[model samples]
Target: MVSTPSPSAAPGAGAAAPVAGTGPARPRWRRRPGWIPAPPLRGRRRVPWATSAAVFVLQQAGTGFAAHNERAAEAVGPDGAARLLLTLGPLLLLARYRLPRTALFGTSAVTLAYLAAGYPYGPVLLGVVVAGFAALVAGYRYATWSALGMLWLGNLLVAHAFHRLLPPGGDPPGSWGTDLFMLVWMVALCTAGELARVRRAERERRQRETAEAERRRADEERLRIARELHDVLAHSISVINVQAGVGLALLDSDPAQARTALTTIKTASKEALGEVRQVLDTLRAPGDAPRAPAPGLDRLAELSEQAASVGLRVTTETEGAPVPLPPGADLAAFRVVQEALTNVVRHSGSRTALVRIRYGAVAMELLVDDEGPATGTGPTGGGNGLVGMRERAAAFGGTVEAGPRPGGGFRVLATIPLPPEEGGAPLQ
Candidate 1:
C-alpha cells in the first residue's frame, strides 16, 4: 500500500516563535509558560556539607565562649544561646536546600526569631541569604520570595528599633551610616539577584534558537536535493514517454520502422525507470527503508544499450581498464552519462550518438557526441539539463563542456579527477 505523507507531518510543523528584537525565531523548550527550574540534587551528600560544618564550628565556639567566661557570656547569653542558634542554622539550611517549600520557610522563621532575641546578626543574615539564594537558584519562586520577605522584614524592624542599640551600648542613629547603608545594601542585593536570573534565561533562549537553526539548514539542504532528483526524472521520463507513444502508433502500419522505434522506446524506458528508482532510493532515510545496490560505472554498458534502443546510433570507448572508484564518483559518472543521453535526444535532435570513457593515470574523461539534425539544422539550446549534468559531474571533482561540434552536431565533454589510492598525487 502506498503510504501518503500526513499534511501535519510536513516540514516546519511547529515553527519557532519570534525572538526578542527579531533576528531568527526562538523555539521554546518547556511546554509550560512559567520557568520550571532544574530539580534539586538528590542524596545525603548533595546537602550543603560546608554550611553544616560551619554550624558545628559555631556551636563549638559558643560552648567555648561560655566555658571561657561563664559570668559575662551568661550575662548576655551570648555563648550558650548563640551557639545553639548557629548550630541549628545549617541543619535548617541543609533541609531547606534539599526541600524548598518545607525546610526553607521553617529556617527563615526560626532565624528571624533567633535574630530578634540577641542571636548574632551576621550569622543570622548569612543563613537567611544562603537559604533564600538556594530557593532562587532552584526556581522555587514563591518559596524563596516569602522566605526572603519574612527574614528581611524581621531584620528591617529589628534594625530600626535597635538602630542605635546594635553595638549593645546606646549611641546616635547616624553612627556607622546606619539607615542609609542598610537601605543601599538591600537594594543592591535585590538588583544583583534579578540580573543573574535574566542572564540565565537569556542563555537558555539562545540555546533553543541555535538548535532550531541547525534543523532548518538541514531541511533546506534536503529540499534542494529533492529538486535535483525531480528535475532529472521529469526530463528523462518525458523523453521516454514520447518515444514509446510514437512506437505504439506505428506498430502495424510500418513494422520495420515500428520495431526500431519500439527498441528505442524500450531502451529509454528502462533507463528512465532505473534513474527514477535511484532518485527515490536516495530520498529514503538510512534504516527507514531497505535499499538495493546503487547503479554506478559498472552499469555503463546497460545505459549505452538503453540509449541505442531509442534510435540513436551510439558507441563507447574505454581506456586504462577500471579502477575502484569511491561510491560517490561512480554514481556521478553514471548520472552524467544518463543525462548526456537524455540531452542527446533532446538538443542534438539526432539519430546517432557516441560515448567514450578514457581512464588515464590521473583522471577519467567521458564524451558524448550526437549527429546533427536529420534535416541538417543546428543543435537546439543547451537547457537546464546540460547545466545539471555539469554540476553533478563537478560534485565529484569533474568539469564538463557542451556545445555544437564544428563538424555539425552537439557534444557534451567532461573530465573527472580521480582520488589517489596510494602515494600518488590526487587526480586534478
Candidate 2:
C-alpha cells in the first residue's frame, strides 16, 4: 500500500527539538511548556551534601555570634531547640532543587517558628532566603512571592500583636522600622533572583537557536550529497548497462566490436567510481577541494561522447552568445542536462537526443528532447532524477518542466536565473 506523507511530515518538518543541558551530552528528557518532568532516577543530580553542610555551618556560627552580641536585647538565648530549628532549615535546603516549593515552604515555616519562640534575628533567616531564591529560579515565581509574603507578615504579627500570645511573655511591641528594613531586604533578594532567571532563560534560548541552525545545515548537506550521487551513478551506470549488453551479443561474432564495447564499459565504470569518490571525500574530509574541477556546460562535448558510446546520438545547439555563469548555477545547469540525457537513453526508443541552450541577459534555458515512442520505462513522477532536477533548479530560483511533448516525444526544459554581472562576460 502506498502511504502518503502528512503535511507535518513534509520536507524540513518534524525536526527534533533540542534537549536541555549545557554540554553535547543528550538529555534524559525533553523540556516542555507549563510543566517539566523530572529525569529518571539514575539521571537525577547528586545530593548537594557539601552545600547543605556549608549552609548549616554558616547559619549556626552566624546565629551564635548574633545571640552573644545581642544577649540583653534578645527575648530568648541559644538553646537545644533553637539549634535544632537552625539545623532543620539547612536540611530542607538539601531538597531545594528537586522539590523547590516544598523546600521554600518548609524553610519559611522553620524561620517563623524560631521568630515566634522570641529568638534573636540574624543569619537565622539565611536558609529561607536561599530556598526562596532557588524557588524563583526554578520558575515558581508566584509561589515564591506568596511564601516570602507569608514569612514577612507572620514575623510582623509575632513581633507586635501575637507577641503576648506566643513565647517570652511581657515583651514590648517591636518597632515598625524593623519591619520596613525586612521589607527592603526581601525586595533586593527577589530582584536578584529575577535577574538570575532572566539570564538563564536567555542562555537557553541562544543554545536552542544554535542547535537548530546546525541541524538545518546538516540536512542541506545530506541532500546535496544525495543529489550528486544520484546524478553521477545513474548516468554512468545506464551507459555501462547498455555497453555490457552489446558486448555479450557481439562477443563470438565480432571480436573487434565486442572489445570496443568492453572498453566503453571499463571507461564508464572507472569515471563513475571517480565521481563517487569525489562526493564521498567531502564527507571524509570536509573543507578539502575536489581532485577535479566541477563539470559545467563547458563539458557538453564530453557528455555527448559518453552518450554516443551507449548508441545514443546527442546533438547540441546554442542560440545567443554564451556567457560566464556563477559556479553554483553552472553546476546546476550541467546536472539538469546530464540527468535529462540519461533519462532519454533509458526510456526513449529513438537513438537520437537533441540539446538546446539559450543564454539571455537575465536567464539561461536548457531544452533536451527525444523523438520517442517511449520504451515504457520513463520516470512516472516517482523517480529521483526528475525530483533532483527540480530541486537543483529551484535552489537557483529557477524552474523545470518534464513530460511527453505534444509531438509524441519526451522533453525536459529548465530555466536558471543568472546574475546581472554574468551578462557581460563571454564564455572562454
Candidate 3:
C-alpha cells in the first residue's frame, strides 16, 4: 500500500537533487531587463537614443578642433563626386559610441578605410575608445574589457612608434597630463550611465508591485459585495413575497391583516435599500451617506415579532448578554438569522419556530429550528436561503450546519466567533 507522507516530509526525496546544483531564488526584480518597458500607451518611454545621436554628431565635429588646425568639419577638402557616404565616413564612425556591442569592429573598419584612402582629418583611435565605453554601458562586459585591453596595448605600441619616428624623447611629460584627463572623463561618464540605469529599473519594479496590490484589493471588495447581496437582499425579498401573498389572500375578509402584511413588505424593502446604500458608500466620495445602517442583532426581537404576525410562531431565548462585534460582522450575523427565519415561513409549511441564542464567553450560537410541511410552516425548496446562512457564519470565523432533524423537522445552527477581548469577545 502507498503511504501518505507526513506534513513535515521533504517535497522531493530520493530525486536527482535537481541536476546536483540548483541555486536559491532571485528576487522579483534584478532578473528583469533594464531597457524593456511597459507598453508605450501605459507610460512615457525614455530611451537615450535621441540624446546619444545628437551628442555623438556634435562630438565628432568638435574633435576636429583638437586633431588638426582651424579647418571647418566639412570632410573631403571641398567636394568629390558629391559622395555623402565618402564625405561622412569619419563622422559616421561615431555610431559606435551611440550604439553598444560590435562598436570596436565598426570603429576599426572605419579607421582602416579612412587610412587606406589617405589619412582622415581626425584621429582614428578616438572612435575605438568611445566604442569601448558604449559596450560597457550596454552590459557587454567581456567585450568592453577586451576592447579596453586592446586599446591600452595599441596606445603603448603607438607611443613606441612615435619615439622611433620623431627625435630622441619626442613626446614630453606635459602631453601626459592631457591623455590622463581624457581617460578620467571617459571613466566618469560610463560609470554614471550604468548607475542611472540601475536606479530607473528599481523605480519601475516598485511601481509594478504597487499596481498589483491595488488590483487585488479591488477584486476582494467586489466579492464581499456579491456575498452580501446573496445573504441579505435575496432572503429579505423572499420574506416580502410570502407576506404579500398572505395579505392578498385575506384582503376581502380580513382587511386589517392585509394592512399589516403591506407594512411588512414596506419595512423589508426599506431595510434592503439601506443595506445596498451602505455598500455604495464605500465607492462614493467622502462624507456621503445614501441611507442609515441596517438593523442588526440588537433589533432581532423586533424581527421575530414581525414574523410571528405572519404565522411563523417564534420564541427567542437569550442566554447571555450580546457581545460587541465588528460592524460588518454584527450586520452579517443579524442577516443570517433573519434569512433563516424568513426561509422557515416560506418553505416549512408549519406554524411554530424557536430561535434560541446562546452568547458564550468567546462566541455566540443561534439555533433556529422550524417545522416545515410535515412539522412546521415556512419556505420549501430554495437554494439561496440556506446557502446564504452558511456564508455569513463562514465570514466571521464561524460555521453553520443545517438539515432536517431526525423524527422532527428543519434546523439551522449558526455559530459566530467573536473577536478576542481579554480572553474572548467583548459583551455588550
Worst 10 residues of 2 by lDDT: 11-20
TM-score of predicted model 3? Answer: 0.63
* lDDT score, candidate 1: 0.59
At residue 15, give the lDDT of candidate 1: 20
lDDT of 2 by residue, 347-372 (tens): 77777788899878778889998898
Q: Candidate 1: worst 10 consecutive residues by lDDT?
A: 13-22
Task: Order the numbered candidates by lDDT, best leading.
Answer: 2, 1, 3
Write the number of the candidate with greater TM-score, choosing between 1 and 3: 3
Question: What lDDT, from 0 to 1, does candidate 3 have?
Answer: 0.57
Candidate 1 vs candidate 2: the TM-score winner is: 2
What value does the lDDT take at residue 131 in candidate 1?
62
TM-score of each: 0.50, 0.87, 0.63
What's the true lDDT of residue 398 in model 3? Answer: 85
> Of the candidates numbered 2 and 3, which has the greater TM-score value?
2
| Candidate 1 local lDDT, 1-428, one digit each (tens) | 11211112111111211000113323566323334444324423566788667755755565455445534422235555666666676777777655756766776776766655543344345555566566565566565666666666666676566645554344223324644554465456555655666676777678779989989977756654654575557545645564555556666766675676556556656765775676566567534543555568787666555544444556666666667777767776777777777666544556657777777777888888777752323224545666666777777677989877877877778878777762145545
lDDT of each: 0.59, 0.80, 0.57
- Segments in model 2 whose C-alpha atoms lie over 4 Å from true places: 1-44, 423-428
lDDT (C-alpha) at residue 320 in model 1: 67
